[model samples]
Target: MAVHLFTEWSKSPGHLDHWERTGREQGEECGLPNLGQTCYLSAVLQCLYHTLPLTHYLISQAFKEDVVKRSPSRGQVVQAAADILTEMDRGKPKKGTLAYFKGVCGRMDDLFAGSGQREAHDLLSSFLTWVHQDLSSSRNACKKCGLEPERRSTISDIFEGIHRATIICPESGAIICSIHERFWSLSLPLNNPGETPLEDALQQYYHTRAIKWYCHYCRREHLCHRQMHILFLPKVLILHLNRYNIKGSDPKLNWVTFPTEELTLDGHLTPGQKGRPWSKFSLYSICNHHGNKKRGHYTACCRSNHPQHVQTPWLFFDDEEVRPIERFKNPRDAHILFYIGVSQVQQESRQTCLASGGMGLQ
Candidate 1:
């Protein structure tokens, strides 16, 4: 199964067959026997990559449940597995330790301590350190203050970091600048710059070759660039409404209604707004062109409009260029540096997307 998932069977037919026949010979040699385990771990890490809601302890217990249900580990193996997962959940496990253990168990060594246990322990230790280093980025605080109190001190950050790390290969120096190229083309709202970190969040991708690219909206990383898609407002609006209660009374309250005019085919690109005095929903505008001369026009209230006109044309639509679903040709093309820096709110879930108006990129 691991071979099937990871290997390009059609591209390397006989090679896959050979590996499958030998039962993951390469993985075994690399100390990972179970491709399924690595796949599972990768999926979990990616899920947590989006947002980690469960506590480390709870995550460990969940892993125990999964492994125990599959194997007749009596309580000993279950307990040991739980311990290993616990260390991983708490960011103490080494790089790929969970997947490695899943691969090496029963094939390479025993877990009853001694050399086998020591190796396992070392793996877990290394994983944990990596998790800490990657996820635990330090925020600068003033000499008199603990400014980064809102930072999430958990393993999720590391997962995101790791996901981001894939695109960067120091050895090859291969890069894709897709995000950077579309930087001006895409419209996004800005937030307080002081609260967001600016370093290499999106900058590193400026020119590095990326083996895989994650869709920000879907939370699935390691995706082919061609598979990427800009989010449409309708779905994004729903997600925001459900998550943040967009319509209900709040300080950020703004009305976002559907279009009275027919939808267009060509999408619009309204410049994103920054600072206050502007509703968050008004930040970016995306209108699909419906092939009509007046296709791009939609209801909207500008500063000059009175309350009645505001309500009348409050619904805005757009018609601009639609970005193709392509792998960022270079890292800079994917560098949402300004957007990320302006929008990163430490207190909010990292995965949470802000609500935009009708015909907007949700």
Candidate 2:
């Protein structure tokens, strides 16, 4: 009987095998159609899809429930967007998803309608804001006290940072410290015209500056040194290079060199927080802008997660075309960089801290 069953199973059609092969091929080369001037949207979506944890969260059942329970109207847009991306991830591509996303955007704002190119950074900001508003839950238990408390939303904090202000009085040698805890992204200014390293740019951001200060303690004015510090570092770090200056519309076409592997932030972490030691991240995605101020194109390069590959593969997405690239041809055009936590211990610690209701700039 066993032999007979085995013979019949072996003789059955290879439909399952064929389907698996087809799915693998499709998933390896999935691309989004250029819906008019929606390349900005496409670039952002591709980058988001590459963020494995975010993709997993979006496609999870929890996200579906949160959307329905929250704002159903605006939530539907996020749901639709997530659903479309989920389908693509499952190797079931839908061209109509782009259309649906566009329709939702149009209904939400008039600025996103029609075939006009928009800034990719602005689109990412709006998308993140919408997603954060809809899916964020307040019921997460605190890891320390084991009680639910009024805390910062996990979704928002994943991308948020702290801006610290320090004032010093020269005459009395008095010092004051203040912290402003909210920044979605870090704006890094370039020094040279052609090239700047990521570390250098970050150093420039936290560099000390001399400012005129009125010391209330001393009741006098004095020249004081001021400095900014990163009070909180998010699990996913998004760095935006300030290429477009206020002087003119022209963008700085300088090559901003960034680490392709590990990005250590121990030096940038807040003083007390530095003892925790979870300041390393792995580069995952990059959004590059081509052309100048008048007219430009957006493209994204993302790390591909395939079990067979020895080294992580980086694939370039230009509109509807997807191709594997050894390295970014033009690193200067890199406008947005995404990095995710790589240390498991650090990740667990962060989760524990968030779960314990210790969610803040510590």
Candidate 3:
């Protein structure tokens, strides 16, 4: 908690010039204009824009084919998304660029219902869900029974993860629950953000917690242990630190030192259940939130793959303003962290020096 978050308003002379120059060479550096309290929205989109594979898919309009195959009704949202991203890619970051995206989302029953301040994590999850539903092969069916065989989509293939929760009654030796589901992100607790480490938070996430429950088999209340397991890991991993406590007005402030290079989940996976056979990830993007829930600003620090700037392939995105970031390895107020498999990182770096895509702001 000794560390303080870096606000976007603070700046110095251009230092990561090499990285910025590389970004300009391989991709466009666009900034988003903040419309009212729309900084949260821009922050998340910026992170997604820098996601090379996603940019390639959406910009190429590959998702349209899936939309056609699935249903015509869903194409509207996908098309709007494509249009927004494409527009962002072709233009520079500035004010009034997010009209299309805002219009579309606003029309969706006034997305987020009505908002002055919105949660980035919620917006991200909702957007991904919409995209996944639009592209998925099936809308309803059993995933475990093979009833819906080809249910995957670009969104599912990239961001989705498989998790299984097992709960056992210690005294009765009977099961109270067993559930499995897909996850788009991992929400970690930050009760004491100042003192919590990234690894410690993760451990708490997968740790078994004891709960009192009535065991039907035992006909009495027993202390049950609930444990979560990772059956599969996604290509792009999103970790959202749960900093907002609705009961309180303020959000968590202290920063947690995370693994900027390589993060391994060798011990976290279910035994013999590594669906993707890859549990190692390397940090690539960060969505840092500054201030509290009432008034906060979001910024993104992304990894750039310019070979010449190997020592510093990182860029800071504050809406439409793009700059080189020398010290992105540890962001003090990183609310959400993005990571990709180490193997995939190597593959992407070799295949593409930079990726092109766009996002909206303000």
Candidate 4:
């Protein structure tokens, strides 16, 4: 049954049977073994493994000191992740499993601890938060100021971005105040997905609006213009299409066409960011949900930038099965989109396409 899906996706019967994908054959990573209902975890692990920045940091073993300094129990999540990523990178035992990482995650987070299934985005979010917390330096409040220090780590540096909203008073257009907030992902409003394009959604995100403000600068209750802009861009940008509502609303299944090659943020950026180099991102990975919240299963389709994976440029990861995907063609199931920063020189070649026929090689 599952084999049929892979066949249709690859459009090649012999592709999945290739011996190289089965084991650790230098530079080739093995499929993650999903025990019955562990497809969500398997998909998440595969997506994270292909995240070059995070995977590189893990394989580089920069977290060794952080692991050693903390209590053995507190450091297990990142350590476990590092172990699993390394195993995937170097390959081992024909396939892969995340027993240790799952165990550690189950221990720290109740979502994975239960016998029942968990959502992929929830699981991914938790894993990143746990790793970031473990690697961050601030565990306790400052001794002198009694303030909890800001948590900082390479994880934050890679995945986080800052947004600033400047409130301007109507009176003489005086600057009221600037509010800055850090975010790991961009949550889009799906209230009206009927005719919204990706660029329109992005524009709405940084849109300027009017608000009733009692600004100290104005010293009165007057209309103030509130404008928001991206203060800082992350190396990896995540767009979380808010499909499932916590209040039990129906999930938005409408498809919005998004640019995979040049998702430029110049218009949404502040004047300050213009001074910096090209502020754009190219699509890297996508976590697609197949069904509704109750019965949905997640799968990841990642764009491989690594030279070794050029042959299989677009790889589909469904549970333990990995194969070349025929085409993306504006995915309606796109839930989480991962975008990576690219320079002007790097953006010259826009191979934003899924593989088709045979191996889908260059």
State each model's CA lDDT, in order.
0.24, 0.65, 0.66, 0.68
What are the TM-scores, per candidate, against the unseen true structure? 0.19, 0.78, 0.78, 0.79
For candidate 4, write residues 1-362 as lDDT tens digits. 01110111111221211212222124444567765577788778877877766776687686776653464357788888888887776655123337777878888877788556778878888887888878886555434224334677767767877777889987778898887777788888666646557898788777889999888875788889999887677777888776675556556545567876678888888765651244577776888888877887878888653532323358788876777666655567778888877656444433432322223322
Pick the TM-score winner: 4
* lDDT: worst 10-residue window of model 3: 7-16
Candidate 3 off by > 4 Å: 1-27, 68-73, 91-97, 109-115, 139-151, 172-177, 213-221, 249-253, 305-312, 344-362
- Judging by lDDT against the true structure, name the best candidate: 4
Evaluation by TM-score, superior candidate among 2 and 4: 4
lDDT of 1: 0.24
> What TM-score number comes out for model 3?
0.78
Q: Tens digit of lDDT per residue, candidate 1, span 8-91?
A: 111221111111111221110011122332322322222221121222323435333332232233333334344544443333
Candidate 2: lDDT over CA atoms?
A: 0.65
List model 2 lDDT by residue over 176-255, tens digit each: 64545457778786646767788988998888888877778866676787867765566678988777754553565466
Q: What is the lDDT of candidate 3?
A: 0.66
